[model samples]
Target chain A: AQTVTQSQPEMSVQEAETVTLSCTYDTSESDYYLFWYKQPPSRQMILVIRQEAYKQQNATENRFSVNFQKAAKSFSLKISDSQLGDAAMYFCAYNANNAGNMLTFGGGTRLMVKP
Target chain B: DVKVTQSSRYLVKRTGEKVFLECVQDMDHENMFWYRQDPGLGLRLIYFSYDVKMKEKGDIPEGYSVSREKKERFSLILESASTNQTSMYLCASRYPGPYNEQFFGPGTRLTVL
Candidate 1:
């Protein structure tokens, strides 16, 4: 079974500053997928970024990027130029190579963007 | 744009009563999923369907059942509601591919009294 763990329960960042959310997972599979999702008060799970285990190069979407350390089993999300709208609950998820794309999510980290 | 919609935004059910949560997606996705969100407990999968009339148990399937009569619709049923079942329910849909970007519904907050 694959499990994702987010060590930080909560974090705060000033607007326009950068923040990094840490995530680690336990999986025996050699190939898998990792994702970061954001859920605001609206409770909509929005995809932030994604990384494939086979790709050593990190994934980036505008201001959002991932630092994927496959050997270390760590995938961290870096949010640059944080905005007030960035305040939300962030989740790190894992999916095995053969699984049905069903995600195993972390406990989540609540991010607060300060003005 | 893909859209996933739930039947309700908020629901209150009594203990021992039956509860049904409906989810519909317009993107013709081959997969649909139901998950429960709890404080400090991320999103836990309850059930999922790969096709019409096909349902699979997820991490936490106890006390929950699902039905998929149509390709675009998936329903989560609680045979007997319990206080422990009170939580936010989310529905998501995604295509069957390596690049899985699921579209999520607004979620239904179910409260068991």
Candidate 2:
């Protein structure tokens, strides 16, 4: 079984600043996927970024990027030029290649972007 | 754009009542999933379906049953609702592939009193 852990329960960042949310997972499979999802209050959950284990380069989408360290089993999300809209609950998820698309998620980190 | 929609955004029911949560996807995705979300606990999979009429138990399937009579719709049922079952239920769907991301619904917040 794969387990994702987000040690930080909550994180705060000033608007226009940068913030990094930590995530770690336990999985024996070499082929897997990692993702970060964001859910705002009373809003739908949306994908923030994703990283493929085989890809050494991190994934980035606008202000969101991931620091994927396969050897350390760590995948962290970094938000640059953070905006108020970035304030949401962020989740780190793992899905092994053979896991049939079922994702194991971490406890989640609540991000607060202060103005 | 892919869209996953749940039947209701909010629901209230009493203990022992039968509860049904419906999920529909417009993209004709072969995979659908049901998950429960609670504070401090990101999201726990309850059930998932890979195809029509095929359902699989997830990490926490206890007290929950699912039906997937069609490829685009998946239903989650609580035969006897309990207070412990009160939580935000989320529905997601994705294509059967390694790199595709799952699309999520707005979620249904159920309260069992």
What's the C-alpha lDDT at position B63 in model 2? 100
Angstrom error of the Cα, residue B80, model 1: value is 0.8
Candidate 2 Cα deviation (angstroms), residue A88? 0.6
Best by DockQ: 2
Where does candidate 2 chain B have its weakest 10-residue lDDT segment? B94-103
lDDT of 2 by residue, A16-112 (tens): 9999999999999999999999999889898889988999999999888989999999999999999999999999999898887789999999999
Clashes of 1: 0
DockQ of all models, two decimals each: 0.71, 0.79
lDDT of 2 by residue, B17-95 (tens): 9999999999989999999999888899999999999989999999999999989899999999999999999999999
Stretch of 10 with least lDDT, candidate 1 chain B? B94-103
Steric clashes per prediction: 0, 0
Candidate 1 similarity to native, TM-score = 0.98
| TM-score against native, each model | 0.98, 0.98
lDDT of 1 by residue, A1-115 (tens): 8889999999999999999999999999988889999999886789999998999899999999999999899999999999999999999999887886678999999999999
Q: Pick the candidate with the highest lDDT.
A: 2
i-RMSD of all predictions: 1.5, 1.0
